[model samples]
Target: MPSLDDQPAASDLHHAVLAWYDMHARDLPWRRPEASAWSVMVSEFMLQQTPVARVLPVHEAWLERWPTPADLAAEPTGEAVRAWGRLGYPRRALRLHAAAVAITEQHDGVVPDSYDDLIALPGVGDYTAAAIASFAYGRRHVVLDTNVRRVFARAVAGVEFPATAVTRAERDLATGLLPDEEATAATWAVAVMELGALVCTASSPRCGACPIADVCRWRLAGHPAYDGPPRKAQAWAGTDRQCRGRLMAVLRESEGPVHASALAAAWDDAVQRERCLVGLIDDALVVRVGPESYALP
Candidate 1:
């Protein structure tokens, strides 16, 4: 038999986290029992590298416009980019559109049930596929998203953050924590994720209120500062990302194809502006209509 030192008791950890979630979980629309698989898939796409509050309004508007994958797919991919509206990383919008088309043509507008099928969709990576499979289908897959990984890093592994990239060791630890029952494992996945998102945040963690605080290895170890490679803050202003955002804003608000000069008016730097516009066109966020004009794709 393995010694207690080998791992935390899964039963106790699940009980604490799930009991906490029962009281404290956020009532996100995608989490509603009635929420369809398509809704959950869309939420996962919008939530990538974006905050919940920012994603909420956009998500609601998007669903209202395109109620199903087929509805979104039936529209031009450019329409998806237009509706995306300042969500940042407009590339996600493009990929989501591609996924919707794939879902409509391949899966009969139903989001795939198996991890393999979900991942096969464009822009649907490991985490997204696992999430759709677990949350939508109530499967017992190991869903190691950012929030879940952070929770595991501190509470289980006694670390300030997970590795810069997911390691094999991390996957094994996550798999080990999977609840035996499929439904319980699904709940455990989202509950742990919620705990990290709301309580054990990157900075200013409210550990005192965390239900699993008593058992958190990082707390028991005195919450040492991260000693790994420094985490870099993403720069927005004056970067290509910001430049792209400005260019996109012009395109999003325009009625007809925007002239090169019209797009140029959004940014002062002619060179950077041109680069961003070309980048947007390459990403399929914009379609060049004429020699000197562009529109949403």
Candidate 2:
């Protein structure tokens, strides 16, 4: 078992991973030293369940428009949703706008440096708050996103995946792995995340390119196939989610309120279409301009 104090062996693993990160970290805008705390916060939001490639242009356009939290706060909340632009899960855009409003109103337009304050903001959860703290402010935190959790699963737990949900055991393991120095701990957090993204991928892990492959518990165990509970993959086609996206696209592509007939044109099934439109309104993704008119909110 890879206990907290795996000792001299773990220390070597840490050095090796960090060294690899220094040489191989991707040149993401948010990773740059000049990236503002607000920028880091924005990246974290856009990145949730979305690919880096998908996020890049949207992030660039978002930054170009709302250069500061104050700038986003100044715009109508609806503009944020419209600008969100098919990123899927448009609620994140609303949450980000709300967070920007909070930052403007309470934090003097500054993205808080501490995890506590960051977590208090809208859309900022434990992972996001920790990421902004560590990546933006160089604070020590156990930043466990999917990527980081996967790395730890393979490298320490000899597993193909972490639990479907984070357990207390997993949380403690990550906390225990933190370096004593704040900056070093922050670096380690991102390094592990990057390693999982680039090398220890969930579908096609390149073990030959991994920094800690030699000491990886899963590798040492001869790469046994996962035999735990089946994981649910996201389904899109013919689903309400896609229906909702189609409806949202109609609203997003329009500058003014769209007629109910126009919205109905986006989807085929009348029952499913109405169900999805009602769900969107319930979710506050759409606002009724009139009894038969709809627009994005």
Q: Score every model by TM-score.
A: 0.95, 0.95
Q: Pick the candidate with the highest lDDT.
A: 2
TM-score of 2: 0.95
Q: Could you tell me the TM-score of candidate 1?
A: 0.95
| lDDT by residue for model 2 (120-199), tens | 98888999999999999999999999999998898888889999999999999888888889999999999999999999
State each model's CA lDDT, in order: 0.89, 0.90
lDDT by residue (tens digit), candidate 1, 1-297 = 333244567888899999999999999999998898999999999988999999999999998999899999989877888888878788899889999999989898899999999999888999999999999999999998888899999988888899999999999999999999999999999998899999989888899999877778888778988999988988878999888888889888997788989887889999888887788778778888999988887
Model 1 stretches with alpha carbons more than 4 Å out:
1-6
